[model samples]
Target: MMEPETRESLIARLPDHADTTAWLEFVQLYEPLIYGIGRRHGLQPTDATDLVQEVLLAVAQSIERFKPDQQRGRFRSWLFGVARNHSLNKLRSLRGQPQPAGGSEAFKQLDQVAAPTSLEQEFTTAFRRRAFRWAARRVRQSVQPTTWEAFSRTAVDCQSAGDVAEDLGVEIGSVYLARSRVMSRLKRLVQEVSGDGFEAIEGELR
Candidate 1:
């Protein structure tokens, strides 16, 4: 989970039009999740890209009006709602349009879709995957090459610690220690990226 201070710092910067750096950071962190949601809902590649821009524009326009209420939800939840609505709008727009008679089954299914639950699940899964990948990248760069190799072999590649130690010319104990350190750092990075609403993802990672 993200610390309260960290969540607030990010929330505070999201609505400021002059905060280009903050906006850029926001885009980098969220664009994949948003874009993935569109694609998962069966949008064409170009249409999904267009939907991404539309959703982001909606966020920029409406962010100033968002007042965080603990009773209501977190900023991330609210952001997801915006993306969901925009995606549904895009899907609805395509419902009655002509398709090449033999369109993909996935594309046809979009016409009858009414609920967002399935797409929301996809978004959650994508978010978790992207968050871990982002954190892993950061952790890899900060750790020693040997430490990262040990962690990767044991934790990521599912290799035996004993074998990894032999390959890395380190003691078995060192491999365990390296894996522990990397896991600890990864947890911190996941929380930093995901905020307090990460219980589900964190549970999966553990």
Candidate 2:
């Protein structure tokens, strides 16, 4: 099984959901999550891609429905549900493969024992955060500290450029300069971490 994603990473990715940046982030962070779901239902790689595409399309269509509800559910389970449905449909459509009996019963039992929202959300949040933290650390190690700090403060911490400049005792122009450098670094890092596969997914959205 793949390691879990952290909350910060997931939240960071969400802010840019419709953008190419967010699409790459999603593939890097959640590809394994989708793959795991597909494998659980006995899907091969091509089938897994089909399942992943369907789930991603569902996410794209219903993204407006995603309100960061710290109250109701985790994106993980809701997304897993989409993948599960798609995977089952794929499995059902396959010819000659014997349908395993009691799988639906198994799902019912699994649902009965489902993890509580708090626990599952906590786990997912932590997992996503760690992933972003890893990417952030990569930038920190490779890029200048000032640049990383500027982006981290403005983008991750939600500080305005003016506020970041004020906090860092720098001019507002420096804040803009730093932001430009950081954005360039992020684009490169995103590509390095996720690759061209994400571009294909984004093309589908377009």
Candidate 3:
């Protein structure tokens, strides 16, 4: 397993054409995360896709500014914040447009629409999102391939656990245990990996 220190160093090594390899690495690591958050915000498929692109573009511009402190949370939070902001802007634009048939009523009834969140709050949300991703990825890497596949098929992909068990030719109880094991490890890994930044920030606070 790569140490947090190693990961940090690799992430920070972006200036010397980090664009060449590091950028690819970063995109691979974060694209799914950004896309998932966009979908969560009620964006349509095309809008969600566009939102992810815009979010990645923003991240490309702003990631150099992130602190290494884990306590400040994972970079995911900040990324999510950016995505959330973009999503809201898109929503607002949609709201301002003439309704398409029944669209006005649907939008009007969406009481859940609130003012855009502060950047800090958005960042906090992104941090949780990233932490979950980080934890899940780490657990996937650590476990047996078959077990990881089972967990991913059911939990990550939102497939029915029973269906996954049937496909894997495993008992329902085994499916439950497999999912739990992956989830448990994921929680632990995120806390451990994310704590590095927190520790660094706390030292400064003291």
Candidate 4:
């Protein structure tokens, strides 16, 4: 099995155009979250798709200069800022609208008109949901079908343990054990996925 990557080492590989594995990994992880961000920010399907391409292109071009703030978080912090900027850019280019800002002007315009505090709060919530979904898919593949069903029905679907046990034809104690084991595994995988950003959203990741 391929060893899992941490955020720092993963970002280091991004600037290498020859590193297709790294690039594909990066896209698989962040594209959905950024696409969801665009949709939640009122973008249409086409616009959201364009926004994903735009943000991904922007990061690929600029990642050589990407710096993680020690006082802040890591690449995700910079990524979300870029996504928010380009998302606003896309919003302003709809029919009957002026051209969206570009270059350094985009940053200036974002500062001038964006309500970042609220928008970022919303984006962070969106990020958590996306992270959990990613973690669910990853963890499920590594565990038995019955184990995942137990956890999914109880923790995700809000079903009672007794009911899940009856339906799965397992003892109640097995349901309880599966729920505990799967949830614990999911939480660890989520921490790997979220990295530096995990602590900020621990309450919501559940």
Candidate 1: pairs in clash: 2-195
User: Clash pairs of candidate 3?
Assistant: 69-197, 70-197, 70-198, 71-197, 71-198, 76-126, 77-126, 77-127
Cα shift from native, residue 38, model 3 (Å):
2.1
Task: List pairs with backbone clashes in candidate 2.
Answer: 5-127, 5-128, 6-125, 6-126, 6-127, 6-128, 6-129, 7-125, 7-129
Q: Give the candidate number with the greatest lDDT.
A: 1
User: How well is each residue in 77-114 modelled by candidate 3, as lDDT tens digits?
Assistant: 55566777787676667786665555554344235644
| lDDT tens digits by residue: candidate 1, 1-206 | 43342454545787888989778867877898888777766777677799889988988998888777542566666777888777767877876777644445446656655466666656666677777777789899999999999999998789999999999999999999999999988877676666634455665566
True-structure lDDT of candidate 2: 0.60
Candidate 1 local accuracy as lDDT?
0.76
**Two-way TM-score contest, 1 vs 4, winner:** 1
User: Mind sharing the TM-score for model 2?
Assistant: 0.45
The regions of model 4 sitting more than 4 angstroms off are: 1-22, 36-48, 70-73, 88-114, 158-163, 196-202
lDDT of each: 0.76, 0.60, 0.62, 0.74
Mind giving the per-residue lDDT tens digits that candidate 2 earns over 1-206?
A: 23233344444455455678667667767766676566655666676788888888777777666654552444566665666677667766654455355444323333343344544444344434435454567678887777778887986687899988888888989888888777676555544443322232233323
As for TM-score, the candidate ahead, 2 or 3, is: 3
Error of 4 at 149 (Å): 1.6
* Top TM-score prediction, candidate number: 1
**TM-score of each model, in listed order:** 0.75, 0.45, 0.48, 0.67
Error of 2 at 177 (Å): 24
Query: What is the descending lDDT order?
Result: 1, 4, 3, 2
